[model samples]
Target: MQTSSFIGAVDIMSTQTATERPILHGGRREAMREAYPAAPQPWIDLSTGINPIPYPIPTLPAECFTRLPDPEAATRLESIAAAAYHVSDAAMVAAAPGTQILIELLARLLPQQRIAILGPTYAEHQAAWARGGGSVDLIPDLDDLPAASSLVLCNPNNPDGRIIPPARLRALADHLAARGGLLVIDEAFADLADRATSMAATLPHPAIVILRSFGKTYGLAGVRLGFALADAPRAAAIRTALGPWAVSGPAIAIGTIALADPAWLAATQHRLTHAAATLDRLLTDAGMTIIGGTPLYRLAATATAPDWHDRLARAGIMTRRFDDHPSWLRFGLPADHTAWARLAAALSGNRPPLANHPDQ
Candidate 1:
């Protein structure tokens, strides 16, 4: 079923001039502190796509702190990651401190070439490639990808959750391969998306590089771990650029255990699914049209997004607002019953929480 089906339809219209629109912000707690110093205590942040309820970290051995990240342990982590992410083999996976770092590293590793990115997605891809001296183009259609030497896209894309099929992407990869070009697929939110939406299962493609985020799915963003999966040569090049001890010892140990835990993975999926449905109802009731987003976040549209953002901010509930699209707001799932209640109250102009909505 469509994620949008849970929400009611709302007509979104805007009358304000560009300059009159208020910028709604949410991400870092420090940013929240700066923007709304007197708003409320213990801010409820929904700005980021990272999971609010993080995985329970296992107790660490003392050696994880005192010892350098062992290569063998790192290798085992890679093996587990490959299995978890559905990549063809462990040899195809390269671990990095975070996918953000890999974005920059991969951009630098590539030859300066024209790049096309699937649009209105993550801003970092454009920024990273631009810094590497590659010309960037944001194209709306998948057919346009073959025109650029390098193509970058987020599967079940960020901000707006758009997932292109694996077969069509494989065709694009083949076209790029023939031209000696590259296809960078950021599967950052694929874990909660339609499982088939991921291209990892069809990997070992010479031209395609699949990027996965451990922290986003596992809720350990601070752990500083991510993976880059590609054909042998590209994976080798990425590893060389990242160098030794690239991921922290603590990260390796945690990742080894977490990546192998299928039971927790399944339960988290179910939990996020219900939470996303609940969020959709809340946003729709507040007069927003459901846009699209992965389970990690929901994008909604309304003429008064800025006003809603302001109201929520005043109540110390920070959500994501888009600069380009003044009518859009993206919300992350609330961490707990209290957060959910707070978000519902904030959206309703700080009224008492709706009694109908039960804790997930």
Candidate 2:
């Protein structure tokens, strides 16, 4: 659902959907409002890959809010995260506010190293590397990767769910390591993905740094917790760069409990799977070609993508429209039945009656 007014513009929409779709903040909401001035009162924001259903946050101790974050609490969070991510040692996992920070940190650590990023993935990887002074190449083909100091990519890639196999990754890792470089895998979207393909399951490697996102998976993007998994020495380097008390007290408390709860993760995974299936049916029904995406979102292609995007926007449904890939529109799952029905009607070109306005 396009909850356009959810975030920084939560005043324009409502606080409820903003909480539901936390990733889309006030600035984007305002931009959407400007883009579609006559858009409905509230939007069903499908612009982000964040899960609408958030983790059930347990009550926090008053200290979690009042006191400075403890080093021990941070350590506990890493340990629990290691077990949750199937990592061999907690020492190899360094916790940070978010993986976005870790991405830049990793790049800056080895500045001026030429980087090869598997293309059309997350734009952030390229941006971060470039900022860190690395000459970046956007490589599209997996058959032949350029010889760069590091190979940066996502596992189940963003925009297009092109998953590179572990055997292939191992070979790449070997090649990069032999060249005295690194293989950075952003497993940000891999929490709900296949565990068998995760690089986190293997022992920590000097050449491999697996970035993990906490907020996107748990639907608690506001809590702001992520990890960088690497060899102990490398992990220590990340921690040092992070300085003291980098992870907030609330984030520590929340992440510790969330990562420790397997039952909730499993239940949420099932729910997201069902939501993705429903979304797939809805998109296909509306004559859109399913291009790619993980369970959290679907990438659809249509010759009339611009028209479709405008139509949906007018009807208060905000799907992701890429400037580069104008034919592509990424749809995050509709949060509720009203959002679902509205999306369906909009996509089908059957605007709901004014009498049915509330749900329509």
Residue 131 accuracy (lDDT) in model 2? 67
Taking the tens digit of each residue's C-alpha lDDT, what string does model 1 give over 1-360? 111211111111122222344222246666556666777878888878888999999999999999998899998999999999888789999999999899888889986489988877776677778778887777878866546897999998878898888888999899888989998999999988777999998878889999999999899998999999998788888988999999999999999999999899899999999899999999988778998988888999877666676677777887776656767888999999999999887777433233322321
Give candidate 2 misplaced runs (Cα > 4 Å).
Answer: 1-27, 350-360
lDDT of model 2 at position 165: 90
Kindly list the per-residue Cα lDDT of model 2 for residues 219-301, writing each as its tens digit: 88888889999999989999999999999999999999999999998988899998998899988988888988898889998
Worst 10 contiguous positions by lDDT, candidate 2: 7-16
TM-score of each model, paired residue for residue: 0.89, 0.89
Q: Which stretches of candidate 1 lie over 4 Å from their true place?
A: 1-26, 349-360
Itemize residue pairs with steric clashes in candidate 1.
none
